[model samples]
Target: MRVHLFSLSFLAVCSTSVANLLGPVYPAPRDLSSKSSRVAAGWKALTGRLHSETSSGSSLLKNLTFSVGLFSIHDSAAESLQFHYTSSEIQNAPNGTRKVDGDSIYRVASLSKLFTVFAAMRELNSEQWERPLTEVIPAFAEYVKSRANADSVYSTPWDQITPSALAAQISGVARDVLPWDGGDLLLQYAIAILAGLNPVPAAVDPATYGLPPVDLNDALSLSPCLANVSEPCTGPLYAGGAANDAPVYLPWTSPAYSNNGFILLGLALANLTGKSLDEIYKQSIFDPLDMHSSYSAVPGASEFPRSVIAGDFTSGFGYDGGISKSSGGIYSTTNDLAKFGTAILNSTLLPPVTTRRWMKPVSHTADLQYSVGRPWEIYRYKHAESGVVTDLYTKLGDAGNYGSFLVLIPDFDAGFSIIGASALATRSNATSLLADLVTESILPALMEQAASEAKKNFVGKYTSDRLNTSLALDVSPSGNPGLSVTSWVSNGTDLMPLLGILLGNENSRLVPTIVSQGTGQVAFRAYTATQEKSGGLFQRNFDVNDWIVVGSGGYATKSLAEFVFEVDVQGKASRVELPACNVTLHR
Candidate 1:
């Protein structure tokens, strides 16, 4: 079945009314030469500036034994900056001062999703997004068998979901509720109830699913939740007890992780080019870019550091770790990560066209936008002097009690990463501090330098036929110029600094025109139950509505229309109406 996925298009126009209202605005960023020099002087100067305002910030995290590292490499030729950081000291702090350098490996939590993204992209590059799960992952069939057991309540086929959907978290597969909460164990307890091993109250309805009668106090007394909880999937019950119940079953096991998403991409890539993810990364990325420390899997973990990392959830970091690894699992140092970023900016890893496609935002949810190449989060930042809007494209990870974060400003060729222990006390605050430091201080400085260097080459209006958007570009006071795009029909409002890497040419002009020969038609289908209707002329109990267009010009007045459809209980369309339509005529 083919789903009608939405696409956005733009129209070109010079509106006098808009121009008069907004006025002729020049694109200018802040003047950052002095600021950049001050910040680059030393960590003392930068951190001192940060310390003056918020004593409660990283200072509070000082005693927590958290390790914070920052590395920034600026490529003057490419006008980009790359950086990363990691610290095992957060995990084994104080007494066990294992200084985390370039090689220290910590559980990267959801940061592993980066690996998944790369793997998926590799597959896409190799022509493998549409392949079957079983073909890509042999162990996936076993998961299907396990979930399809006679007593199992889940009846959905594993193959019904796609790798991309799983990576994007749109598969509709309900995540397992960890037992830390007061909810009943849905899987194991349900199984026990079905097996008659657990007794139900005589007055209770057998069909009504209720929380397992297992007392939390008793369970806690039996075994603590933190002990031996190697694989998260095994113990669907999040409460205490059975922490060491070897072979726990979290909703997404290792096989399920690979099968559900990550491995599918790996398999797709392998099938497309007859090369494993390891080989592909080595050839296409690592070798070419000299990212020597980067690897698909962590080093010294097993015979094949890569293969060992792909073991069952029991042997790995449980569901969270497994899922992220499949998607974002990549081990690299700050230096190597910087190299990777530079490679991307310089189009060393992939061609410029492919790089732009990778960075193009892919819709995950209404609120969140991601792309094949990067993960992004909407964040609000406050600096001493100014507050600016920053769409921080970053990937975050948390493995067991370890975590890491990597953020990139593609437009500026600037980015930073923070890796540390996953312990609760320091994880959130520390990561936030690191990110703030980068965004408020480090990245701004980097962007200023890049802007200053590339000032001459980056002045012009850039229009997109695909997005039906046009950006008026000019240099900023800081060096990087501001790009302002007036509102189009599709995008509701004017966009400032239309933040995206410029694809195609600076001199290219895009004009939006209507296709006059064709008439556009959109249909709504409804289902109904009525009397036993047989043939093509059968009658239905419910009423059906059909919308038809007799002429082309009648519907061609506007360039964009937002329509709403109403359906009846019988699944038949009651009515279809165009609520609002906006058309912009190109000048």
Candidate 2:
């Protein structure tokens, strides 16, 4: 049997308008303040603990060998405060130790899965979730077949995996397993084994099976395999290794790394959206929320930076198609990450209902503290004062060897991200320290401020021509926005029957775009092919106080278009116009 691997270079052709038509731009505050001294004190205390745990000696906060940067934001109706910090001693090898800024970039492994989950959710909201994975990614079928046994009981169609399931790691379609090393030939050997061509014993100790030392070349070469092997073959998890027989696939020479499950997800998302993962992310989330410093690829595209966190290697890794690129490929500053946390907690991007679904704890298995949002973990935090335990929605990422930590804390409307490289494993203490600081000093000060401004600013319908989607904004009883496309509609009358088929109980976010606006005749555009160049514009009929399409002459192009409406302010939307191609705006 011949196996054909899809070339990683195959680029998806996505129309630029997919993002533009989805919605308008949503901006976040650029800077934070320090008006609340109490909050600042708390932050100081927390940061002190973080340093105590991670820094070398009690004095001067030195002995830290890795590069580190930290930032926190507190929001409120009255004022907003922000704090920034960077370690002076630690240095990046190639770049040397430099003063890290809020915008400095670092690899944020596994965290990239969040973008994948969001892309999958977008497809679900568009009612395209049921489309076979083969339709979006033909190569996926091959992986599915090689990974699963014919007799395996968990045999659901690959396309049947919902966005929610993928986010929660419940899809059970296992190919990307944990613990990777550089071993190129082992991948080919593994692939051969999965294809039933290699006659190697079903059970062999990976350490004893003539496996080469774990390294990058070996990881890229390992063929895709199911998480489970044949029955009774359980042993220690088989970290990828290399074979010595083939000189062509050398660990040190090859540019590919295999540990990236998320990169595959990026490919899948790009194929499904007809655009690159980076473009989709910028359009769907980054541009809207104004996360300027965040990006999927490394700087300059020529030389990817080394991971600052220790335990992860520097030379054996390359960004091209490695596991780190997809599973944990994001490089961003602490300031940008903090903004992401605020946007999620404040419902600035996704609708309230959808946000709730993302934060909902779907899995409660004891081994797993919480499950719902794609990359986020549901963990419980004990209130320091009350001794009461409360569920906290969080996500964490470690570049493994790089010694970087990315964390998001939704319940507190606060988050912190740290990047550094230490000679010792204990260097991860920097992450713990930052997390502690946010929980203690930063969040409380920011919560009241976030609550006050959020209550007033985010309660209404927002439409965007760029994305061709609409969002209805509303506040939850807990003061968070209940953003979801599942509850959205076109105006108050048009019900989207397709939503029932596409999402059913699954939650989604409504993307929208503006057509045109005027004092008397405000018009809006929806989803339509003809109006691709000119986002559909609607003008208000002065006499009826209702919105009406500004005629073809009135529009830059007289083409039929589709439009969506957000009703009930749920942050979800339904297609409202197809034939009419226009909508009336009302305050």
Best-fitting candidate, scored by TM-score: 2
| Per-residue lDDT of candidate 2, residues 1-587 (tens digit) | 00111121111222222111211111111123454444444555665665564455553224333323323333432122233334443344445324444455555555566656665665445445434544555554554566565323433355444333444554444434432433334554565556677465534324456665554244343432324434221111121211111112211121122223344455556566777666777787678768776776654533233223222334312343333354666666556666666666666667766876676655543332233345555554433322222344555554443434444554433455555434444445544444444555544444444333333444456553543444454433322122233234444433455543332222222222332212211123322111123332332122222123222222334433323333323222232333242543221
lDDT of each: 0.38, 0.42
Q: All candidates' TM-scores?
A: 0.49, 0.52
RMSD (CA, Å), each prediction: 17.3, 17.6
lDDT of 1 by residue, 62-161 (tens): 4222223443233232212222222333324332224444444444555655655554564463324544444445444455655555322333344554
Q: Where is the poorest 10-residue window by lDDT in model 1?
A: 15-24
